[model samples]
Target: MAGSQGEGWRPARPAGWRRRMARLPLLMYRAGLGPLFGNRLLVLHHTGRVSGLDRTVVLEVVALDREVPAWTLASGFGPTADWYRNLKESPRTTIQVGSHRVPVTAHFLSAEEGGRIMARYAPRHPRVARRLCAFMGFEVDGSEDSFRRAGERIPFVRLVRSPAPGPAAG
Candidate 1:
């Protein structure tokens, strides 16, 4: 399940310095520097499935729908990523984008929907899309069809802002 793309497609877990570097963005978010990252990145706050403790992870925003106030994210490390798994176990969570925090509910997108998203994304961020696909061990030909196929192979989740809580009854 880890290597759906191919053997060695999934990246090994980072450790030591690499792990520290990966978590740097989280620190920035905590330090109120989230605005510096704009909307390109977001900090996800979720509860660990087994530990039942709060956890945080920074993920890239694959798509943003301001109208719905939703953000789409891809599990670059595949669905086995701890963050991705945690979300599956606890779909209710919160995300911080540019110093703005919003409660959200995770919604897993279907493969066909993911394909459409990838097709739309590639044209907008060709370089990032190509690099991301390569990093995920996908050989894309820089074609919409190729990107769509690659997107179908990966897991995508949309974090939609939860409705504001209504006033409590007396």
Candidate 2:
């Protein structure tokens, strides 16, 4: 895993059994193991744009917006990542976080917004933030500026949950 995390790596989409095996973690979370991850990780249930089939992926939550009740995500595999593309094709989806599931709508964030978010995140989660930058094929000196630069290069999305039915509506 460490070798694959190198900056030179630019892996294409997983094929054959690899793709099938990747869903195992997602399954674990959906099968009531979500509490182990807390809010840092989430399981996204989405539909493939071309295949029109439901898909699931476990992603790390880069940021959380309590006010808006949203989770911000980053594509470590770059902007053209399959799940990211799929969300763009169908913005409406569901996310499972810490034993809870909710309907969400995807909203792409600007590079500047990503920069600000990354800068703020670095101090709070220094080790994880650095690891994330490394995994994303970036190098950082553990500074907010360095993290911001790396963040600007990655694609981020804000997943805002849909409003629940009020008592009057029900």
Candidate 3:
């Protein structure tokens, strides 16, 4: 599951925690368990916020926001999630699907966009979404304030496939 990394995007861990987790199987479980259990997990490679080292996180590919061409990570522990913060700091990132690794740039959605995405998610996974919303302190109201209170704490980003690097000249 290890692979080459490049610039952009932020790692979703908090310093010491990331290092400690690396030595345990929990990191693997958090990064791979869902994918291993019949889910499409997109592996994201991001740089550490402090160390500037690379860190990989596995997140489920829930839905593609057609209007923005961005993938929605809604209600996945709300908007305050770590990965969201990483993307907020640096949108450029790498997404690894199976053996295919592609470079992409991320855009953190505004309150309006995030609200719409959250609405779509609620219908699909009401129970989980509610749990996430509650934990993140968000109401079902589709307003910027609600999103700010709930999502600002979590991390969310919309990614676009980045152009491939040109062939190197000899």
RMSD of each: 4.3, 5.5, 10.0
| Preferred candidate (lDDT higher): 1 or 2 | 1
Best by lDDT: 1
**Candidate 2 colliding pairs:** none
Backbone clash pairs for candidate 1 read: none
How many backbone clashes are present in model 3?
8
The C-alpha stretches of model 1 lying farther than 4 A from their native spots are 1-9, 164-170
How would you encode candidate 1's per-residue C-alpha lDDT over 46-164 as one tens digit per residue? Answer: 88788877888899999999999899999988888888998898888888899777888899999999989999999999999988788788879998999999899889999998875
Give the local distance difference test score of model 3: 0.54
Candidate 2 structure, TM-score to reference: 0.81
TM-score of each: 0.89, 0.81, 0.59
Q: Rank the candidates by lDDT, best first.
A: 1, 2, 3
Q: Estimate, for each residue in 94-165, the C-alpha lDDT of model 2 and write its tens digit.
A: 888888778888899999998888898889989988877776767788877888998887789999988652
Q: Candidate 2: which stretches are off by over 4 Å?
A: 1-24, 164-170
What is the lDDT for 3 in model 1? 27
Weakest ten-residue segment in model 2 by summed lDDT: 161-170
- Expressed as tens digits, the lDDT of each residue in 1-170 for candidate 3 is 00132223222443596657544433554555533523345667776565666676666555664454455454254344556666667667776655456677876667666655655555676675556665444454544345444444344566667775111100
Question: Which residue pairs of candidate 3 clash?
Answer: 79-154, 79-155, 80-153, 80-154, 81-154, 81-155, 84-155, 84-156
